[model samples]
Target: MTWIHLLSKSHIPFSVYKMYKGDSLIQPKTIKNTHILVILQGILSMYHVLNKTEVICNSIVYTGHIITSNDSDYTYNYISLRTSYIISLPITTTDLNQYIDHKIFNQILYNYNNTLKQNIDINRIFIHKNIKFRLIQIIIILSMKFGIIHNQKIMIPLIIHKIDLANILGGNINTINKILKDLDDQKIVTYAKRNIYVHNIVFLKYYCYLLR
Candidate 1:
């Protein structure tokens, strides 16, 4: 009964992209102007590869978030962090202005802009911070976004590897490993087979605040 369902039943066209974990989502070269990406399930890591070696993580797109893809140049690359379902609506500005209700259309754009701004803000705020602080902050972000509450703790179900964290924070793998070990030693978080369990989120928040 949602607007999306209404659109699906209507004349407007959209594509549902299914991606497995670690799959590269190559943006179709034919797409021009803009398209709206709605994450129906799982997470996506948006980044730009430097020298085809380093991955500079731009943002994390969570389920239900609307993302605007306007770059015809395709400067960013999207990778699935977990099995995901993405709805790509190739609705242009002209289409929006013509077909959609003004209020609803405006709200969609506003939500996308706000989410993009928040991601940019997080990157800017943590750019100058220590690696450990950055790592902890990201863990907090992911835990809140993708976690399930169980046994009075937060359990992040995604199988996020050390290399993934390293890529995200732009840190060395060994350094990220050491930091994870330290966190584990302190009982703040436990990593088992790349799955993260936050044992003391309160302490993690306090530590993050102190580092800020």
Candidate 2:
């Protein structure tokens, strides 16, 4: 699918494509165009070549984030998912400048620029709490967008791995393991293999402070 077809009315010029493992996706060279990835399913990891850092896992990359390709020669990077639906917008700086609100865009641009300036540790502490909030937000957004399949109970085809959660939460593998164990102890979630069974969504909402 093309960006025109996905976002039919928006004047944003983009192209949409489905990618899987070994698809020869773009390697990590910087480009003038902006890409937005809305994950329909599966997982993905973005790695920064210059710093040798992985930005986030299973993250839905939006307009605000800056990324580098794993390969230097190409304008794209490899996606670490079995399958993903992605939209690439061939946008000029002028087009982006006009579309994005100036203040927010400036802030994002500043952050991206700063990120490129130094070697960033993937396990930084400055954004720990904010990272948790964002991870929960992603869950809420996915819940609303894709919803759950009805059976004797409600289930979502959550194909996420522990390492992926650690990346998204900006924590270590052991930390994520602890968190999942805590959640399991509370009976809010159950996991088997790579699938997460949300047994108690309401309880989870309260536990995560999304509800009171």
Q: Top TM-score: which candidate number?
A: 1
Q: TM-score, each model?
A: 0.85, 0.54
Q: Give the C-alpha miss distance for residue 132 in model 1, angstroms.
A: 0.5
Error of 2 at 28 (Å): 4.8
Residues 93-208 of candidate 2 have per-residue lDDT tens digits of 77666564544345446645543442133333224475444444455544544447655433546566777666556677887676667667877665568666666667666766
Local accuracy of candidate 1 as per-residue lDDT tens digits, 172-193: 8999989889988988988888
Cα lDDT listed for each candidate: 0.76, 0.50
Off by over 4 Å in 1: 1-3, 27-31, 50-54, 71-74
Q: Which ten residues in a row have the lowest lDDT in candidate 2?
A: 117-126
Pairs of residues at least 3 apart in sequence or in different chains that clash in candidate 1: none
Off by over 4 Å in 2: 1-16, 21-30, 34-50, 53-82, 87-137, 210-212
TM-score for model 2? 0.54
User: Best candidate, lDDT-wise?
Assistant: 1
